[model samples]
Target: MSKHVDLPDLIPVFPLPGALLLPRARMPLHIFEPRYLAMIDDALGTKERLIGMIQPNEVPGKKAGGVHRIGCVGRITQFSETEDGRYMITLTGLSRYRARDEVEGFTPYRRFNVNWDGFDGDMGPTERDTGFDRPKFLDLLGRFFSARELNTDWDTLKEADDELLINSLSMLLDFEPEDKQALLEAPSLSTRRETLVTLIEFALRSDGSGDMMQ
Candidate 1:
């Protein structure tokens, strides 16, 4: 079965730091700001129902804070409105995109002209032949979790496939914004797993200072 949707030349962008959305991964977002609330409303009315999630640059006094070139487009799967006019929505990732151009101030929210050529593979099944050192990684994760007192479901974690484990952990873990972007931009699942392991190790070694993990 093929899952296909029309790829638009232009798309609405949500610039958030440390929020990573990989293809086939679902990310939940809270839309409270007037601009992003408008974004969600527009997406609901559109045929594609897509929104681009990109990381913003680290800089002071910048509007939209400058977004990264690469991003992932996700379809709004579920949404509910609060009495305060805020929206709670879950985005099901469809594909990854690279920004060829950005159009800011065109709307209350941000918009971008995206090219999806490089990440065509993201929509397909991730490679699993390379294998993962699950036990070793799990041991490291155990240490990190113990230090932070974060609970873990050993059964579920052990049963998850490589792609799910790698992508989900990368998104869930509290790495720096740039570190999260690095995981999002990883060329392959294999590399992402490696990067994630390195990040966890680095975080464990840190002394309460936020350092960008490689």
Candidate 2:
């Protein structure tokens, strides 16, 4: 899908640690907190139903540097209200943005003025990693999973396309917040793939006992 011409400059942001939403990928989120529930309600009233997913950077003393500079904007594509008033929502990523400024408002949730520069390709089309080495990657992945005693549908993973396989693994893996942030900020699919491999290799080398997931 092409970029939305009406994509707003200001957007509500959800500060979640280790949560990532890459373009062309979908993330399922549960809205339970009162502040976030209000954020959802206000987002649903917008034309695009858009929200920004960002990671919080807690500095030792600087409270101003809380939110990360980069984030992915996603549109709420699926939503359902539970019996207790919580919301189950799926966000389909639209683009990666740089949070230029924090917009102070009376609303409960935080908002940001974002810049979509350098990420035009995010909204253009799904990307494929031409240099992806599937067999080798799977071999490493198998070892990693086995070390952690993690079970997955190997057949299904084999059938998934390059983008889906890489991005899904990047999202689902129990990597540290900084590691996941690196994956999110990677410029391209191939770069992200390389980053994923390096992360896994590091995990393997650091501890064969599979304590990497911890």
On lDDT, the leading prediction is: 2
* lDDT tens digits, residue span 1-214, model 1: 1257888889999988889999889999988999999899999999889999999885677674677888899999999999989999999988888987777575899899999887778778765726677887888888888778899898999999888888999889999989998999998999998899888878777845343323
Clashes of 1: 0
Query: Candidate 1: where is the Cα deviation over 4 Å?
Result: 1-3, 59-64, 104-106, 207-214
The lDDT of each candidate is 0.86, 0.90
The weakest ten consecutive residues by lDDT in model 2 span 205-214
lDDT of 2 by residue, 17-80 (tens): 9998998899999999999999999999988999999999898878764988999999999999
Worst 10 residues of 1 by lDDT: 205-214
lDDT for predicted candidate 1 compared with the true structure: 0.86
TM-score, per-candidate, Cα-based? 0.90, 0.94
Clashes of each: 0, 0
What candidate 2 gets wrong by more than 4 Å, as runs, is 209-214
